[model samples]
Each structure stands twice: as C-alpha cells, then as structure tokens.
Target: MLSFNSVSSRVLQTLNSTFNFTATRHACKITSIHAITSMKTQPNQVNHSVELGNRRKCLLDRPGLFGIKRGMITWFNDNGRQFPATVIEIDSVEVIKHKTEQEFGYTSVMVGAVDKLKNVNNLKLFEQAGVSPKHKLGEFRVRSETGLVPVGAELKADMFAVGQMVDIKGITKGKGFAGVMKRHGFKGLAATHGVSKAHRKQGATGGNQDPGRVLPGKKMAGRMGGRSSTEMNLEVLHADGDAGILVVKGCIPGPNKAYVKITDSVKLYGKSIESIERD
Candidate 1:
C-alpha cells in the first residue's frame, strides 16, 4: 500500500487539477475556447482582478496639484468654536498648456488664474490662455503623459465636490521680526521680581560644559511666518460650476488676499468618497 502522506499529496494534486479543468471547460463552453485562447495571446491583456486592483490603487493615490490666484477672500464667518470661517472662492482657471515627458521629463498642466492685464505685460501668454491677462500662472503634475489638456480648458469649482476632503496649500501671513515668545513659543522668564530685561529673552541656549556650541535650530527670535504650509482634511462645503466658486469650511493659511492651491486630500477617514462627476 502507498504511504499515507504520499497518498494524501496525490489526492490534493488530483483535486486541484480537476478543479482547474472544470473551470476551463466551463469558461470554454460559455465562450468558445478560441475566444479564451485569443484573450490569452493578446498583448497588454490582463485578468479582471489585476485590472480592477490597479484601478483601485490609482483611485486611492489621486494626484494633488498646485494652483495660484490673486483674489480677495470675498467673505468669511465664524461658526463659534475652535474652527472658524466658512467658504472661500478661487475663481476661473484656464488651461494654458501642458508639459510633456520629452520636454520637461514629466507630464503637467500649466493653468492661469486671476487675470491682471497691468502686471501680465506678455501679450503672447494672454493670447495663449484665451484671456485678457493673468497675474499668476500655476502648474500641476498628473500621473500620465496625455498630450496638452486642450488650451482654454476651463476649470471651476465643479472640479471638486461638496463633502469631499481636500488639502489646501498656501503661504502663511508674514509676521516681520518677532521675539522668541511670539515666534518660537518659548516660555520666557517670570514677569515678577528681578526678571528685568530678560523677561522676553530665550534664556540659556546651551549648557556650560557639554556640546559647547549652540544647537543649529535653537528656536531663537527671528522672522516669522510667510512659509508654505498645508492644511489637510478641509471639507468642501459647496461647488458652484456656473459661478466658478468653491466654498471650503474651516480656516486656511495666509492673509485675506493671499493665493492658495487646493487639491484632493491625501488622507481620509471614511470610505472613499466618490464624486458625482465620476458617475
């Protein structure tokens, strides 16, 4: 008699072969075996699972690109809490041109925002954008190298949807020269009893013995703000395609008239929120 282990191994092998043969025969019956064979030989053909998985991953890693504008904050209001403000409008963005991998070593679309004829003296750039003139032009990189996105392709608030999260990137408001207490948030010396002029000072920067020199990033008093920053997970309150306006909830960096770039949020808490535009 055959050994028990060998018999079990053979049984498993036979079962696997039988299952595969049954599946192949069933598929062939549904569609002729010629069709199956053709699909197998086709170039760039992939299984449904593989195709679906790749699509899913692409959806998850949605590209976030930058945009620029020179518009005022229109309006804002506090909702009574740590989070304040509702709605911001960054208007019409027209696609000027696209950069290809051959020329730029990457694919990206160049968009023009906030028209200002006085500053934009380049008449050719205006002619290309199909607009009078623009104060700012921005470029955003995408995943693929699909030719120019079509000159004059208008982008509006409709590109994003309400209830979806987004990442807002902008330069923070500049705060000129500042003290350590205001800039680096250092707890200065006590205000009472012999504290003297050292009240706002950064105190002992380094110890006497060890290390001998001050640390590189010692957080001393200096210029503050005016740096690129990102505010994540800001909810889009509304999108008006006709008006080319986007209403985003929560505060954004920068002053009233500062420019900012908005993109789909990299991280989201709930299930992937599909936009109505996709449907």
Candidate 2:
C-alpha cells in the first residue's frame, strides 16, 4: 500500500492538471467566438447611437434664457407699398441701479437712457445717477431682477442681431381734434346731392325713445393721434456697430427724431434671428 503523504501529493497533481486542461479549452473557445463576431460585424455598419445621444443631450442642456424686453421697434422706408428697413446699431445700455422687493417692494431693473444736463433743483439726483451730460434720461422697468450690472457698462447693437424682430413704443403724431370723416372713417354725406354742414357729422347718435343720451365710449370724432402706441414685429435690417444705429424695415410708431423705446417684440412670430431664418 502507498504511504499517506505520497497519496496526497499524487491527488494534488492530478487536480492541477485537470484545472489547466479545462482553462486552456475555455480560452480557445473564447478566442474562436471573438474571431467569428469580428468577421460578422461590418465596418460600415458601426453603431453611432451613443455619440448621437450625447450630442442631443449637450444641446438640451444649454444654459440661460436669452431675449430682449418689449416696447422696441425698427424703422425703414416704404417703396411703393413695400416697406424695407434694418436694425443697425443700439447704444450700450447699462443698468444704473436695481429695485428689490425688500427695499422698493418690487423687482425692476433701472435702465438709464441718455443722461441729461445737471439742473440746480435736481443736483442730488444727478449726483446719485453719476451720468454724464446728456439731453434726456429715462428709466425702463424690467420684468425680473438681473445680475449686478455695474454703472458705465455700455450696451451695444450686437445685443440684438440681424433678422431679429423688436417692438417699438412711441407717442403717435398728434392730429389735435379731428372730424369724424377723417378720424372714425365715416362715409360722410353724398358729395353732390343735398349735402351741407352735416357732411362729416355723426348721423344719428341715439334713438328717439329708448335712450336719450349718446352711449358712452361711442366712436365719435373728438381727438385723434398723439397717444402712446406700440408696433410689433419690426424686422432688424442692419446693425452699425460704430455708429450705434439700427435701421429697421418700415415705419415706426412716432415721427422722425421723436423719442421711442425699443424693446423685444411681443408677437410670437417675431422674436430671434433663428425664428426669422426659419420663416
């Protein structure tokens, strides 16, 4: 009979040999499988879904909402019946100050327009604003509070780009007291037949018995024009960076040289350059 120690050593060697044989067979099987898969896969049919998904995610994660405020418009000339204008340049608009809910009980950005000359009565105001000598100064209220925009931070026409639509706010040209024929689009009396001073007069304001007085808010002609108006979706034609001018296509709300507030357009169709490009 074999000794106990010799028997144990023989058993261990046998186990090692069986393990090595099984491992070698498994390795050969794995290698063959890999070669078959490589041969089956076509180079031109490589999967790109992962890369495409990453790119889509990157675009969706873009930060911040970029848009302009309302009440701004661009101006241009009308050739025949067609209007043509472009937005060129807008001055550097800076946030001089802000109003917080805790202090002023509201959130607003105090945007200063052109500065004005100092007046003796408004000495303190001039000192507070620290604005240079200018002809006019106005404050524009923003919808929400923004980051701290330091004084002297000038805004440029590039804030807006070509093909953008803006809303313009201005006082309409005054027509004083106008007649019904001119103001309310009344047909007026017959030109030739029995017609006298009653030509432009409002025909019949009220009935005989039902209502004695003329109804309130009736479209009678008293005064026309000279009121605040907002024109929307004026296309930005060109932007002159150095000159700080924005040439827009078509007529704006106010007369030439009149002060107007230019803001982002409220109309859904008119907004950014991308939207215009699509149209």
All candidates' lDDT scores? 0.65, 0.55
RMSD in angstroms between candidate 2 and the native structure over all alpha carbons: 20.1
Off by over 4 Å in 1: 1-83, 146-148, 268-279
Residue-level lDDT for 201 in candidate 2: 82
Give the per-residue lDDT digits (tens) of candidate 1, residues 1-279: 799878866765675576433234323223346555444464775546533333333233223333433333333335634434445555556777777666765556777776674745777976866765666677765545443467777777777877788888889989999999999888899999888878888888887788888989888889999999989898776677786667677777877667787777756621121331365
Which TM-score value belongs to model 1? 0.64
Model 2, 175: alpha-carbon shift in Å? 1.5
Give all TM-scores, in the order shown: 0.64, 0.59
Off by over 4 Å in 2: 1-82, 86-93, 118-121, 269-279
| Per-candidate total of colliding backbone pairs | 0, 30
Displacement of residue 272 (Cα, Å) in model 2 is 18
